[model samples]
Target: MMNFHFIWPLSGGLLIGLSAGLYLLLNGRIAGISGLTASALGWTSGGVSILGLGFIGGVLAGAAAVFALLGHAGLTITSSPILLVVGGLLVGFGTRLGSGCTSGHGVCGLARLSPRSMVATMTFMIVAAITVYVTRHLVGGF
Candidate 1:
């Protein structure tokens, strides 16, 4: 049997929701990491580019702080460098093609009850499940 730790997951979810809500309330932003990353890279055309960069910086800093405090015991990635790069590229492409990433569609969009987001989220979930099944069962497994 698998042991489930509920407190950490719940805490993480609450933090995510709170941050997304605050971002939306304060800056009228969706807190989508992919969109913000594009904007930070100067690919997005608008006045929010600077804010996007700041947000990205904040994300990095937060991650660094967490690692520094927590010591990264179970957070190590064993994937090959090439696989990681390819996976990142694929995810970026998918985010662009889908018009939004999970954070935007799954979290923020669902919160607002958007039909488009509902469809997108459903598609994302289905595809993710398929990918996991294929990778874990058909392939050697991740």
Candidate 2:
């Protein structure tokens, strides 16, 4: 069976919630990574908001720090570069089409008890389950 490590996961979840709450409290903004990234990249109307750029930088720095401290042995991608690129493009498109990413709907919106977020989160979970089933069972995932 799978080994369950509750402490790390719980800590991570708490950190995420705390960070999101802090962002909202400080900036009056929802901590959605996709929106922040888009704004940082100058794709949004404001054209590279400093707030978004700072948040993205913090995210990257935090990830690098974690990787440096813990060492991620399983971080290598098994799929082809083309597949990875395509997957990323698809995810970006899907996030735009959906008006928000999983973090936005699942974390912030759900926390606020939003009906639209409830529907979006359910859709995200269902689609993820279907994708996993198809990849693992039907196509044999890499």
Residue 109's lDDT in candidate 2: 92
Measured by TM-score, the strongest candidate is 2
Q: On residues 6-72, what C-alpha lDDT tens digit does candidate 1 reach at each position? A: 7766877887899899999998878888898888888877645888888789878877876787788
Q: Give the TM-score of candidate 2.
A: 0.88
TM-score of every candidate relative to the true structure: 0.86, 0.88
Candidate 2 stretches with Cα past 4 Å from truth are 1-5, 73-76
Candidate 2 structure quality by residue, lDDT tens digits, 24-75: 8998988999999999999999998898999899888977877887888436
Clashes per model (N, Cα, C within 3 A): 0, 0
Residue runs of model 1 more than 4 Å from their true location after superposition: 1-7
Position 124, candidate 1: lDDT = 92
lDDT of 2 at 64: 85
lDDT of 1: 0.86
- Clashing pairs for model 1 are none
